[model samples]
Target chain A: MTQRQALSQSTGGTARGPALALDAGLLCILLVATPMTGSLTLLGETLRSALLFLRELSDWMTKKKLLAGSLAHYEFGVEKLAQAWTLAIALAMIIAGLWIAGLALDLIVTGESQTTSGGLALAAVTLALVTLRSGLQMLPFAQPKPRAFRFASLLVMQSMITLAALADDPSIALLADSFGAAFVALLMTAAGARLFSTAAVDLVDHPLNRKSEAYIAELLLEAGVEEEELLDLRTRRSGRDIFVELTINPSRAGSFEEARQRMGQLRRALAEQRDDLDVAIRLRAPGADSG
Target chain B: MPGPTRDQKSKEAAVLYTSLADLAVVTILFFFAVFTSSLTLLSEAIRVALMLLVEFYGLFVLRALHRDRLRRFRFGIGKVEQMCNLAIGAALLFSGFWVAHSVVAALLSVQAASTPLGLAAAAVISAVNLLINLLGWLAMAAAARDGDSAIYRAQLRARAVKLAASAIVQIAITIAALAKDPVVATLFDGIGAAFVAGVMVTIGFKMVAECLPDLLDHPLPGETKKEIEAALLSAGIAGEELLRLRTRCSGSLPQVELTLAPAGCASVTDYCRRVTAVENHLKDHLGGADVSVVVDARKPAET
Candidate 1:
């Protein structure tokens, strides 16, 4: 990619890299040492076993008059050991969710097949891939940049959530009730695609994108910075900032400050340039560099 | 004359080329290991092949960052390097997973290749790789002599690590090739490759983080503070007050805020001179802390 494209993509969140590395390493260490920590995990498992035993005990107690109390041992066992084992559980949840959802959908939807377990696996993998990369992208923000792609990406994420909720399969009720992986992935993909399309438009230096269009419109209304002759305007985002390098034919001679302040004000309303526009008003003697 | 100047950067680039050569030679050996159908040789060659990217990645990062002052974020493109680093790490990690997959497949399958040719290639490539590593080692040692060169020094250290790892891989490949089993060779090579990639991803991740912290507006070095603090203290003020300080990496110098000890406290000219002096001190210490003095009475302690 060109440098501009790369810089445009380098949002502040990329700083997450160090934290991710640190977190992953910590997770691995915890996974390796879990056997020694037979404290919480073992306790939970023991409680689960006790609960199972009590189920039998309670039935017998009900029949006899002596010890008639039901010993209800709550067993939410093995849930606390969210180490590498968490990954296994996540995989399982993904699998079970897919299997149930697919079966239900297949029952209702004529053309759909319940045996697309592999596709469900692929969906889980895809989500994992996106999440993993998104985490890395967040790493840049640690250092702080003047601009970032927060607005665009966040819009995309939100859309995914909305689309997923509204998405309908042929067996819509079954898919929704069963909470299938296929259903989740499908909605997510549709939402993401919508958001990405907008982002893509923004990336291509679309002047009509909300920010620039507002900026140019604002500029036209300004009496101070407006010149009768300004043309071939182009603009693009750099992180949170918007840079515009265009030629203007001023209405007669004017103070440079007057022109600068106007353009500066316009910049502020658009991106980081709005309140933090760093303006470099270079004077052009009509025929400066080219002519 | 203080140091080798920009030439040091060129030398680092040269070091990268040398190490990549070592990898290329090892890859040649790798092909033979597969051909000879020696489990050990194939595995060893695969191991070496796996690590090739790690060496290349170090080169890429070191070479990219080895120049110029920190550019102002106003241009917004400086962070492009970080993006490139992140992209590269993701690619390497994905490739590592692929390498692991292949290893598992080979472990289960009856895959084999021709052997005698692989052994001869391994021998030849090992000698060539050793030579390349030596060149890289010399370049690294030369670069490190300039202790003041933080960026170049980092490059040197990264290259040295690659050189050491490549040498280790070469030894393993030779041993595996002698064992005469292709499966063993594939296993050794595949595992080794994945491990090397893991290391690269981790390293790349870290180096990028260092730069990212600055992007996040994390506090920079205190040289600017020292100047501001010295300026306030120069006014003969009593007690240690921080005076408000805000800093951002703008253009040429980082804009630093140094709050004064309030109105009734000290000589403005002397305070101003001291502030100016501090600004100069900051500019010297912090390649370019803009040294802008903001006299804040409310946040006096931060000065």
Candidate 2:
């Protein structure tokens, strides 16, 4: 295993544990509050929280399995599986979002808003919990910046809707609750759409960024590989694993031994620069077909 | 990367046409489901919507594959297809749960019966849906008849399940609309929705089970492995020179990676030719496969 992979395996659970616990706690609170208050907004929150909980649970389980070395046999590691999980989460979010939106629209159309007596209290509690959750997620160890930003935006939106629901008129309060649920649904759908696109690209083996590609080429050149000798170079990323495959015509070296030594140097140099990288160097024979 | 073959193009076109047809049917069903407010129709609508999502996803992946857009992937598009299947199965399971939940809620609540007009509309729409699903099933079956990939086979199976569910929906709606007894109507409605849920769960479970092992990079079947070994032996690759051989499936594509200790080859050119020959031989034997052969130039005693 590469050093980065080892580090990730050791610290993966620690990084995700607190966030998962927070999500579970918030999910439980919303689950209990949704039925008690009959609040559509709370129901939406509960569903969103449940999906988030599932996502975290899957990540945790995958990391645990990685740590146990059970997934080592996978040639490309479990990066594709992680990408698949992301796709699943995106689909679930979109489905949940549409369902919630449908329910809210039905209520609006029928003009049969139920009296949610404790909705304000439930909203306040949830807003507080989500605020805390967002704060925790912002910590470096918790999640990626984009995800943290998503949660933070959700906090702002949740706060706005909660304030709106504090109206004196019951009818206005109900409208606020319905609109709040609709807003939550929109947020979820947008996030899901973004995640879906990213996962789709990754699953198709999108190439590494140009800067990284340039750096790898520079490293190979620095390791005494000639520019013309480098026949082909391909780089791609899956989850946290980066793969670099190089096809080289090592005719510059006088013998196979010298060529082998050059390949080792290239591998060691690349490994030192990026621990997550898996490098494959293919020595092409003169007059051989590229295939 | 090579361009997609004639058979591949035909398969892609078939998938695209089916998905477009599904989109049209689902769009119409959505409106009818909203108007009728029949639980059975609503469940069917939701189920079809989910299926459409997966169908479109599969179509996108298929197009990408045919266009050679994913050539940078060393293992080909097998994992991507598997991921698509996993998403489809997961979506099916989710829809099944939602349908089951709605069914339970309806059974517990004292609900008003649908208007006569609504019931009539639902029955008509369901009958149309049944016919569409039947046509889709046949189309997919024809497409998969030539022995296609995992995605195509899965689509065929999904189409079959959709056909069965559509039949159930049509019958349930017709019975509920004609039956004089309210109890019988409600019972049939619940049963129909429950059956749809059951169908979804069963197919979803099967897809997930079949795709998970492949996604996990489990080895190819023992028989296939033996064949691969025999093929390698016949190709003049001695057991000692073959340092490592790993075989796995990506969707329906077999992937084989071989590491060889380039022992007695007169030159690098000779070794490359030998490896190329071995790859071609294996590809021919395996029908088609992604075969990668790497030469380990280090001596066995280097360690």
Candidate 3:
């Protein structure tokens, strides 16, 4: 794909890579199956999941003894149930919108399976997907870009599946399925390749090590250590950890006892700042200042 | 004076050749993915494309700055590296979120379908990614011998994200094969994707966090601070009378400001001369020193 197309596809655009692949697979099934089997099978599959969800919900509620409670307790349970129910409703809406859009797109493209329910579903789903995608795309930052495209792909695939369910000609469904499969496969491969390319780039630098080293240097300076008094100042990284080595001026730092106390304080401060650093402070007295 | 030292020429060639090789490899990978016709493959290819864009931009900035190719940013373009680091983090975050969202959708829409072809494709992609990751590691090892380089770190982070994603895809494929129930298979797939996404997000956040302090002008290293104090003392300022020493790094350069007491009665010219001398000494010692020194009249005992 061109860079622009790839960008649009990666972000929230009409093209959804993985979802489109799924649509192709579903399209193949639709082409092979008659309308009676295609649409009805989809309906049956949807119903089966819905029933399974309800059964699980029922089991959970029974286990929790949701109904075996006083009026106040019952009220609290209802509040909790309402929150869950709201989420379930939203999920149902998105699925419904997707199913309708799929049916509508198939009808439009194939010039078949045009029914009143299909028409209404198409219009409603189209409007919903458009509004949702637009709204999501408007959100600040890159957070919503992938999500918006995901919604778009869902709409497209569902629309294709709906059309496949209603299509009278097996050939059209098969053709769409084949095309979709090829497209999806191509998209996935491209994505994998992108990942591979990124994998090839491994940075050799450790910026964190540098920063920590600088922080340590500042600590020593603030502790009354002369800059020139520090000898063999070295900092490096071993994996994720930073190692620091420096010599301090002890003679200028008052008594030997005081210098030791200052070193302790500096070490404590550094530890508090970064739990990952290994600092070694060597004290050089007046005569021992690398004469 | 020389046309270019042997080491300089070698570095120049390494940078140029590496960029070209990287572009060539990714371009070839993109084409290969196009022919493979796998969603998982394409998804990664898109990431690599975006990565190449960021990598090249970072390299371009780095090369220009190293070669003194940019007049506007003559001081340094360390911030460009920071910005690139930020971009890489943001990109990974975006990809992670994308993968998570897709996984969730798939989990919700679990269907009873066997995807042998998709599984095989994912396996192939995983193998290829692992191989590339291994190669990247070797390159990293070679680079590390020369001291920790920022460019290599960025590349490592990016490589890690892709490696994790590939490994997850491989796991998902295996799970799909073992799970008889399509729902179970879909669940495993979703979980694998989520795991990979989590890793990507975590690494991305870490990279961004690490770069922030550098960009924000964090204080100079402790050793550098000690060195600054030593430089001042050696320049005739006594350490006991030195009231305060403040130091920070701006870009790749050291910046220092100090307050000290002069030894004897000195004229304004004498003080300026001393400050200039200290500044010159710092520049020589610390390298690229931006120094500010003030002679305070009060001694340590008085203060």
The lowest-lDDT stretch of 10 consecutive residues in candidate 1 chain A is A72-81
Model 2 chain A worst lDDT window (10 residues): A282-291
The whole-model C-alpha lDDT of candidate 3 against the native structure comes to 0.51
Ranking by TM-score: 2, 3, 1
DockQ of each: 0.03, 0.30, 0.02
Of the pair 2 and 3, which is ahead by TM-score? 2
lDDT of 2 by residue, A176-287 (tens): 7788789889878887888888876666556887798898889887777778888878776776778777878766666555666667777777777777787766667556
| Model 2 residue A187 distance off true place after TM-score fit, in angstroms | 2.6
Q: Where does the lowest 10-residue lDDT sum fall in candidate 3 chain A?
A: A197-206
Model 3: fraction of the reference interface contacts it also forms: 0.00
Instruction: Tell me the spans in candidate 3 whose CA falls farther than 4 Å from its real position.
Output: A1-291, B1-44, B70-74, B111-114, B160-188, B218-247, B251-253, B257-269, B280-303
lDDT of 3 by residue, A1-291 (tens): 443453354333533435444434444443333233333223322332233244334433432343333222221112223222332333343334333344434444555532333543343343344335445554765656545654555455455545543556765554443333333333333433443332222111223335655677787667555578675465533233454555454444544344445666776676667665656554433332211
Per lDDT, the best of the predicted structures is 2
Higher-DockQ candidate of 1 and 2: 2
Fnat, model by model in order, equals 0.00, 0.17, 0.00
Q: What are the clash counts of all predictions, listed in order?
A: 64, 0, 62
Best candidate according to DockQ: 2
User: Over the full model, what C-alpha lDDT does candidate 2 score relative to the true structure?
Assistant: 0.74
Rank order (by lDDT, best first) = 2, 3, 1
lDDT of each: 0.42, 0.74, 0.51
Candidate 1 per-residue C-alpha lDDT over A121-228 given as tens digits, one digit per residue, 9 for 90 to 100: 333333333345445656766633312343233234333323333445424422432333344433333433443344323222223466655666465455244454
Candidate 2 per-residue lDDT over residues B161-247, each given as its tens digit: 878988998889899889888777777777888999999898888888888777655778889988998999898878887877777
User: If you assessed candidate 1 against the hidden native complex, which CAPRI class would it receive?
Assistant: incorrect
* Residue lDDT tens for model 3, B1-303: 224444444444444555455566567667877787545555556666666677676666555545655433322345446656766776677677767877776656665444866655555755665666555555544444343246545765676566667667777867776677777776676677788889888888888777654444446666777877787778777877576665544345555656554554234334344555666677787766655553332323435
